[model samples]
Target chain A: MTYSTMKPKEVRQLIREKKITTFTSGLCNGYAQANLAILPKELAFDFLLFTQRNPKPCPVLDVTEIGCPEPKLAAPGADIRYDIPKYRIYRYGEMTDEVTDLSTYWRDDLVAFLLGCSFSFEGPMLDAGLEVRHITENHNVPMYITNIPCTPAGVFSGPMVVSMRPMKPKDAIRATQVTSRMPSVHGAPIHIGNPTDIGIKDISKPDFGDPSTIYPGEIPVFWACGVTPQAVAMSVKPEFMITHAPGHMFITDLLNADLSVL
Target chain B: MTYSTMKPKEVRQLIREKKITTFTSGLCNGYAQANLAILPKELAFDFLLFTQRNPKPCPVLDVTEIGCPEPKLAAPGADIRYDIPKYRIYRYGEMTDEVTDLSTYWRDDLVAFLLGCSFSFEGPMLDAGLEVRHITENHNVPMYITNIPCTPAGVFSGPMVVSMRPMKPKDAIRATQVTSRMPSVHGAPIHIGNPTDIGIKDISKPDFGDPSTIYPGEIPVFWACGVTPQAVAMSVKPEFMITHAPGHMFITDLLNADLSVL
Candidate 1:
């Protein structure tokens, strides 16, 4: 089947049947792909406040009302547990196992959060003629641990992690302006020009993903990575935390254009 | 009283008594002091949609029901007619008079809208050690009519106007991250580095306010100005409109900190 006409629910059906378990990026082109974080109902409010406070790092696309698995705003009629290509189960902040299906792990007390991913902004950036390094390289964009702190809420507190891409200063400026229109999708670049300024001691080695080539006059621009919230969630050592493993994301029915402010 | 000591309501009361009608810059330091626009009920729905559609430029803080002057969210129990240090009345979209009071002009059908202003973000910026150039220079930030077209709603349509401040590239980056947190206010710098990029022909001569000094290392940063709604309202040639004159803002009983996301 052509990727152009594939529907999100169709894609989800394949994932549920174990026919498609690979990373779900660049599929369903204009539709938004969200980061998933399922937590127990008791921790939902704190997690909600955490996202509300640290919006840049955790721009929430939708939060299923407690005990519900459906993300009404992002993806209706889709099961959160089995729709995503992959999921990671953690116990006491430690990764327990990676699974393609979560039907066995699903709990009624779990509240699902569909977070805005960088892929939403990447669409506009790619449309603007700016090359997304991750897309070009066919790999995940390099993410670095930063000195910046996420605003603490309840049990969530940790340093902000950022994804980096090298761009000419002019392109960096243009990217900032374009991304500012979509605050829900990590909004704008958190730090532009120097990675070391944000406390990334070594640009050559990222905490996540492969480092990209920074040509002469090309500056490294970093945006508040969505990994921040997931990291914060881990730091709290939530007895049971469920998140999509890196690269695999929950595709939503909503288009990326719907998130634009202007 | 010290700025840190005074409560938002107390400061608003002081402004109402004419005991404090200065810039109101640092007062009520944390709560959100909104940009005011009082328009006839006929244009209220369109104007509401205008803000809704163009949230980046004109963030609707609170809207009063027809004939009611109270902004329950921004400044409850406060008189919109007298709380503002100064007001500008426009007839057929042209400025006709400036006054300290709007008592005589207050109509039963006038709808009061409290839109978010840069002043709300200024406090957070200063708290983050980002210097707001206009505040430091003791002058209004330079504003320019942009080539960027605002989304049209009914009879409201025009170019977005932006306020510019020159800062180092790092500060501009931080400004984007900081302001992006406060979506209620005009969030983040719209453009950075070049004035001509946004169609501002001369950097020295702004369409409004005193142009400040741009030093060697400074990069010009622009933000969607609150002036946008007023400019859009004017271009449509509204029969009657009232706004806060430049620097003379409506002092709301809300703190700048109250508006911050995290």
Candidate 2:
């Protein structure tokens, strides 16, 4: 079946039935895919504060009510527990289990948060004719943990993580203009030229995702990555946490165009 | 002294000295001015959540550390307790006193919050050649309470209050495009025309501020007002609350250009 051609609901239904169990990129072409984070109700306010403080890295798309599996704001009528293709359960900051569904682990005290992902902005960048190197190379975008400290919230604070895409100076400026309209998806590049200035020692060696090729005349541009929140959550070592597996995301019904301000 | 010609610090100093005690609409030229709110530490988290849930009306510029008298992010050297031209003290949801300095009532548990005001975006709108009716008439902009309910958080929930600016259809469109870039300052219009559509019954009569003139070819455009958070705070009726008197803003060191996304 052509998953790319399927509607977001159709894709979610397939995932719910255990028919599709891989990552969720390239599906629902024009729609937004969100990064998921589930935590106990006790930690929900602090985590929400963290996202509010560090908007660039953790732009909140939708937050589910306590114990509710449906993301009523982002994807109404869809069950969050089984909609995502894969979920990683963390116990004391360590990945203890990888699962396709959360029926056994579901708890009434859990709160789910859907955060904006860089994938949403990349669509507009590509539409604007800017080169998204990772898409061109068919690899995950390079991500680095930077020295930029996220504003500390109760038990949730860490250095911001950034995703890099190598582009020419002109393209970088254009990309900035393109993404600036989508503030919910990590608006604009944090750094455009020198990676070392932001504390990224080596351009080629990234802490997460695959490294991208930087051709001649192209410079590395970085944006706050969605992984920072998940990483911070892990660092805090909450007793139980659930997050979408890398590259696997919760597809929202909101179109990419809906997020643009202009 | 010409308030418009003086720098933000100069204006703030004059205000601190108890000399220039009036509305601060055209002061400091290009710099940004903010609305101030101070609440107890216990209510800080809930108030912050309220602002987060309602960014359009309550776009937070900077929040001071608990018990701090200065807004570290917006104006490093200025004292939040006394720098603003005037302040209104609220006790159990009622305005008990209107004072120039909060030093008399200062407490160790207070938290200061500076929210973005529409003045920052009005500069751009005027620069774009769109008519700002209230500014032309030399009166406070007309504001009304709308049927639109703000996203509730904790104990904060109230109808949205919006300020109206009359403009031609073409100008309204341009104004929307212009303000869309300034999200921190109540970005874009929530309603463009027909006040009754948003539960506003009479055009001339407003709940707050002076009436605006809607010329024959012009329409009343509404932008979420910074007054919202304060109104919500009043409704919730915390034991103690402090807010800048209407039109008396807290001047910041940051320029209007700094808040522009593009």
Candidate 3:
């Protein structure tokens, strides 16, 4: 069966059945794929406030009620515990387990948060006739830790993490205009020209994800990434937390067009 | 000197000195004007969450630090207590006082929130060659409480309130595209054409502001208004709250162009 041509529900069912336990990239092309972050109820309010304070880094798509596995808004009737291809468990800020399902670790006090991912805007960027360097080479987008401090909310406080994509200056301008319409999906680029200006010491070395090829005329453009929230959550050293493994996103029922302001 | 030609600081100084205690419409052309909401620090977190959950109705421009009278980000060196042309004080949701200065009610525990007003986007709408009906008729935009319930956060919850601008179908489309770029101000029309669909019983009678002129070829286009937050706050009936008097806005030093996502 072709995964890209299948509906979001079908793709989710395959993941739940363990038939598709892999990265969700290139699947469910038109639907939004969101990053998952689950936290205990004790820290839910503060975590929600943190996401609220830092929208660009953590643009929330849907937040499940306490202990509920189903995401009510983003994908009604979809089970959060089993739908994602892979899950990462963190205990006291240390990665303790990686699982395909959360049945063993499921707790009644856990609240699930689905955050907007850069993948949502990449589709539009590609459609706008711009080349996505990372996708073209089939590698992860380069990500760096920035000096920009996210507004502290309760216990959640840290510098922002950003993903970089290289494009020609003219294409960068068009990409900015295309992505600005989707504010829920990281909006516009935060920094357009120089990576060093935002505290990145080297453009070739990234803290997370793989490096991209920068053509002679291309400039590195940086955007607030979903990784920032996960990084912030880990930095807080919470008793327990859950997030999706890199590139293994939660497929939502919402269309990319649904998020467009225009 | 013409108020329009004066800098934001000069206009703020005049308001601070009680020399200009009137509606601030059309004064300080390129700069952004803001809606004011002052609440006790105890309720600041929940109120901020409310705005976060419903950004269309409450696009926050600057939030002052707890007990600080200065809006440090939006207008540096401007006093929140006396810079506005007029102030409205609410006691248990009742409008008990309309004062020019906050000297009598000033408290150390108060927190001020500056929200983006529609005035910020109107300049661009006019520049795009679209007629702002309310401005053309010299009246406030007609507003109505809609049936659409806001995403509740904490204790703050109420129906979404929308301000209407009547325009031809072509102009309405253009207006939407123009305003969508300015998300800090209400981004785009929540509902267009029928007022009854959103629970507006009478188009001629608005809950707040004046009725707009609907020409033969024009349809009512609604944008989420700043009034929604104030109305929601009143519904909560906090022990003490303060807001700007209708038509009297807090002028910010930030340019309207600064809020554009593109």
Candidate 4:
């Protein structure tokens, strides 16, 4: 059976059983998929405050109760500890291990946070008739670390990171209007044209992710990247953390349309 | 000088000095006004989580660092303790005192939260040429406690409180479009037409503010009220809590337009 046509619960169950241990992209099409960030209860409040202060870079989808694995609002019955296809363990800023299940690592003081991914907005942008350059080029969306400082909360503090997608000026305007309706996902383009204005030294060499081709007459439109919270959290060097490995996301029951405000 | 034309900083200065101790309705006209809620650090995480879960009713504008008096993002260099016209001190869900400054009651564990008030959207509604019944009649916006329960966070859960404005069916649609762009303030109506559908018993008598006239062709429109957080927080009956008394609010340096997503 095609994964895109399956229910979110079915996909989650498959992942939980370790039968589907690949990246979650294109699975459960039309449903929202979220990035995962799990921290000890000690860092949850500061990390939550960090997301609140830098909302564009870090739009939160749901926050599980302390010590709970279920993301009650985003996906009621799903187990966050096992629902994702892959999990990366980060200890004090360094990635220590890759695991599929976190039963052994789970603690009574852990809090899991589900953050909205840019993937949620891509479908809408495509539906709006705008060609997403990275998708067209079949490469990962280019990401850069900008000099813009995010507002600090407690021990959490760092620079803003943005993902770039090149688009025509007219399409850029239309994309802004389309994504602005979905603030729960990264809302709108933070920068339109000049890359240096926000502190990107080289367009072709992104700090993370593969660089996409920027055609003539098309500008690099940037949106606050979902990588920000993870990057910032790592900068603080907390004792321990768990996150969904790259492209391996937690598929939510919510439709992409549910994130739209209007 | 007319208060409406003055700068937000100037108006806040006057309010801090106790020279203008009344409801801050028309002062700093274009700037955004916020509802205040102060709690000890012990309850800050739960309250913040509550606001996250129930964003429509309790849209957070800014949260102060624990024990800090400045709301750096909302109003830089301004003291939250004395910026508002009046504050109500609640001890275990009971009203104990109303004071202008929090200096006497301030503690190192206190954390102040500034939530978006409905006042931020009224300007856009007026600009859209819709008649706000409460503003036109010189009365407070009617508010009611609904039977719909808010999604609970630890130590915080209660029925949602909503503010009502009577308008024609067409106006309600337009108002939804107008307000949906500003989600930081309560965005869009939760209910329209019938009152009892949301558990509002009486159309004339409201739970909080004064009721406005519902015209022959007008339907009562409801938006999640800012009172939800305060009411929910008070229901938990913390040992100590503080909130702005009624119409008196914390005026922020941010313009009303700043809150708009589109």
Off by over 4 Å in 1: B1-262
Clashing pairs in 1: B30-B255, B30-B256, B30-B257, B31-B254, B31-B255, B31-B256, B32-B255
TM-score of chain A of each: 0.96, 0.98, 0.97, 0.98
Model 1 TM-score (2 dp): 0.57
lDDT of 4 by residue, A26-55 (tens): 899999999999999889888888999999
- The first chain of model 1 has a TM-score of 0.96
lDDT of each: 0.80, 0.89, 0.88, 0.92
Q: Rank the candidate models, highest lDDT first.
A: 4, 2, 3, 1
Residue A172, candidate 1: C-alpha displacement in angstroms: 1.1
**All candidates' TM-scores?**
0.57, 0.90, 0.87, 0.99
Which residue pairs clash in candidate 3? none
Where is model 3 chain A poorest over a 10-residue stretch in terms of lDDT? A44-53
Q: Compose the digit string of candidate 1's lDDT tens values, residues B1-262.
A: 4854688677767767888767667665566667788889778756765765576799666677567776655677888888888889999978999988788899998988787777777778888998888898888778899898886765778999999888898999888888877776787678898788889999999998889889999999998988899778878788899998766676666666655444
Residue ranges of candidate 3 with Cα displaced over 4 Å? A9-20, A39-54, A64-71, A78-85, A99-112, A148-158, A238-240, B1-3, B13-20, B39-46, B64-70, B76-79, B99-111
Classify candidate 2 by CAPRI docking class.
acceptable
On the 0 to 100 scale, the lDDT of residue B222 in model 2 is 95
